[model samples]
Target: MPKLLASAYKELLLLTRDIGGLAVLFLMPLLLVIVITTVQDGSFKTIKQNKIDILLVDKDKGEVSQTIHDNLRTSDMFNIIEQSNENEAQKLIQNGKYQLAIILPENLSNDLNLKIAENVDGILAKFGVDESEDLPGTIQIEPKEVKLFFDPATQFSFRNAIKSGINQMVSKIETKSIYKAFQEEISEDSNEEIFDTESFIIFKEIIPNSGKEAMIPNSTQHNIPAWSLFAIFFIILPLSINMVKEKNQGTFVRLRTHPVSYATVLGGKAIVFLLVSLIQFALMLVVGIFLFPLIDLPQLNISGRLPLLFVVALFAGLAAVGLGLLLGTIAKSQEQSAPFGATFVVILAAIGGVWVPVFAMPQLMQTLSNLSPMNWGLNAFYDVFLRNVGFIEILPEIGLLTLFFIATTFIAIIYYKRKNAV
Candidate 1:
């Protein structure tokens, strides 16, 4: 017990003396979280609070074209800039002056109405309602295309959304035209309305709640947990470097003369670094809770989940420390350990949904992400912060992290003993 405490004290002293390492561990992550959160918050607000600029070229100058223009103008999503020349609109889109443009074909309204009227007449004659010999046996109407011009830089998802919206609007207009044609044929003498144009089915979004209030996750909620986990795992870089330094300096040789096991030495390093990880997490929470709102970002709400958040952080720290121990044991020098540790952490973060979300990734990458310890930690953090889950709900992720720590630490111990054996 005395040896373990003394070893922990020595590790603490070494960490405190390295000012640059301490700065890297603490300051860089704080800045990263703040900047990333701010940028993402702006993106989140783009569709809801800001309008996209779109050019409308109505070549038809008919009821259909006018209706399309009116719909675009009325929609909160688009800021319509009417352009008379289709060629000019296309130029503007290609030059990136505008993100999108919609072109309605000439005589769209007339042709659409004629097609509907002819179809209705044919249907009425089939039902024996129209007995007139003047009814044509065949009907033909040329198809009209609505052209969409998009900026080259426009995202595929945004383009798809715009295309879908325009298609839906045109379909509604076509349906209304059909209804009017039928009404005119069925009841030419009546003055009352026949068809209801208003939508019957509407979509409603349901958010999961904890019997109190719904915990809607914003950028702050997402960035804080994600980047904090990143910062925690990044401890491996310095931790591994420190281990390599001690070996290079003959500190390990001096410690061998004492009555100590390698596990005790590992335990000492784990205790100090675990405390550092917890402190790093706490500082991140402080910044999210306090600094974000001042910068016009949403405040992070930990509320009753603080304890569970810490529990996940603790286990995540253990996993990080275990990885550091293994890397340090295997690596022969500081140059080897430092680069590998940093690069490996980045790879883990990339695959673990730290940069891009798991759901957004391809099927193969999503499958591979399960192998990362950072993914486990990130999931556990999200379960507490966003999902508002309890300890029991987060047990699976916590269990995985615990097993990772045990396995890595065990391998590191075995490797160290084998290498130094008489």
Candidate 2:
């Protein structure tokens, strides 16, 4: 116990003496959390407003085109500016004023009505009515298209949503047109029982999206966990370099004379770096939860999973320390450890989704991200911070990180024994 305490004291002395590295250990992540969250919070404000920039140009001088146009004018979701000229609408879209433009082609109503007349005539023939006498005659439709002009640069939240809305509007107009023809047929024949077009489609209220909306885009929810894991893993560079430097300088040689096993020495140093990692985690969380709200930024709502966060942080620290030990024991000197350790940490961070969320990555990248311990730690943190999940929900992540720590610990210890035996 005395030897272990001495080892820990020695470790802290080494770290405390390097004042600048110590500052980076604590302050850099705070700065990143604040900066990242600020940028993302601004975007969230726009999304919460739920407004769309739309330009509508209707060339068809008919009831169906006019009806759809009138609906757009009153819609709260669309901030539409109707233009009589399609060229003028195109100019506005190019100037970045609008994301989407709906161009209703000329003769749109005539083409749709022709299809409706053909359907009605078919129905009349089935019911033993003369198609020529009882039904409105069908005309040949000169096919024309409804053009959708959009600015590709505009940050349209849902591409499918805009398309779906336009489709629904067109369908409704076609339905009403067919129903008008059906009413004419009902007047001539006594079959109101089989065809009640007025009450065919029912409209239901769409409840607002639940707060569990995927990918809320809040920086506070993302930056804290992401940057915290990044900062923790960054400790590897210094930790591994210090180990190799001390070994090269004969510091380990002298320490071995003490009345303690080498494992005790290893355990003590791990404790120190692990504590540093935990401190980084706590400070980042504090800034996200308290300091951010004061600046009108998002609150770091942990969603009542503090214990799960602690468990994740604990395993994450162990994984980082184990990785550091492996690199330090394998490297021959600071020259070998410094660049290699930093590069290793950086590559792991990149793959682990410290800069981007794994859920948002390409399918192949998401699969690759699973190989990184940083990803496991980050996923666990996201579960606590974003998903409002309990400890049970994060058990798999915690277990994976724990196994990673155990595996690296064994590898590092085996290498250390081999080096010492030589």
Candidate 3:
């Protein structure tokens, strides 16, 4: 036990001696947390602000078109700008300058009036206009107006607000037409059911609101958060590659000759690298707290399982270091060890939900994820943070991760002994 403790201590001191390793153990995670948090927060803030530019081109310039344009301009939803033509509007959209553009068609008023006239109480209404300007008795015309185009950039909040405003303006015109038809039918002594039958067309069944509207789609949020945490955890690979660097520098031989067993030296190195992983985890957690509203850290009700969660996180860090150690110890040189460590970490991280969430993946991929410590570690974090689970909820994950640490550490020990035996 004393020998083991001494080995662990020596490994820890050796890791601490490397300035680059110390920086990685402490600073790299902090940097990643800062970056991800900034991006996530900025994106959500842009969505909430609901600021989108729209270009309007009115071809008709008629009263109805003007009214439609005015309606859009008056609303707080859009930053409406008048453009000379559709070409400029499209150019702006292509350049990502505007979210969407509205184009008013020529004769917009006439088209609306044509629809209005169809429901008019008239007998001698002609469908086509005469080519010759012949003398006519007189005719009253009503116009139907429409928005020729809508902006695709306008999302639900902005679109809904615009839709509501337009509906209000059009409802008055529609109501007058309805009243006129009702009076005509009443005068003709038609049965009430005839009018009632038409009323059904206007009324629709109400759709009940579903529970807990997600801020973003569940799949997007779930996968992003899960993978973000996975990256932070997978950083252990680069950190552990330093062991191979030490071996190449002759430090490994010198340390072994200084009355230290192979286990003590390697064990200490693993602990130091493991410490680095933990620091990164903490930095990510801090960034999540300060930077992204998507992650409600303080609200995470994992008090009952905090201790267990910490233990799991710590063990996961150790497991990552152990994997790195096994690879580094087996490789011929630091150059070889570095790439192998990086590739291995990346593969494990990918499978573990660093790049995607297991739940959102296919069944085959989900099964594959079970082989990665990252998958288990991230799933446990999600359980504590999102699902409000207790220690019992994550026991299996913790146990799996603990076993991974033991297995990897054993492999690393055996490999180191074989490679460095004097």
RMSD to native for every prediction? 1.4, 4.2, 8.4
Question: Which digits, one per residue and each the tens of the lDDT, describe model 3 over residues 1-422?
Answer: 67666666766666667788667656655565556545655566555556656778878787666776776767656677888878877877767667667776787666555544444433323333323345344355534344434455556665666556666655644554455454553456543333332343555654232342213223223433454445545554555566666777887778776777766766666665666666666555555445445553221233354565566678677667666666767777767876766677678777887765567789998899899888888888766555556678788987887888788778878877776567
| Cα lDDT tens digits for candidate 2, 293-404 | 9999978776456677878898899889988888887889888888988788888888899877677889999999999999999988877766666678898998998888
Deviation from native of the Cα of residue 297 in model 1, angstroms: 1.1
For model 3, the run of ten residues with the poorest summed lDDT: 212-221
Clashing residue pairs in all predictions, respectively, total 0, 0, 10
Model 1 lDDT at residue 8 = 95
Ranking by lDDT: 1, 2, 3
Off by over 4 Å in 1: 137-139, 210-212
Question: Which segments of model 3 are wrong by more than 4 Å?
Answer: 58-77, 82-84, 104-239, 249-266, 286-309, 347-372, 414-422
In model 1, what are the clashing residue pairs, if there are any?
Answer: none
lDDT of 2: 0.81
Local error of candidate 3 at residue 111 (angstroms): 4.7
TM-scores of the candidates in the order shown:
0.97, 0.83, 0.64
Lowest summed lDDT window (length 10), candidate 1: 206-215
Minimal lDDT window, size 10, model 2:
206-215
lDDT of each: 0.92, 0.81, 0.62
What lDDT is reached at residue 165 by model 3?
63
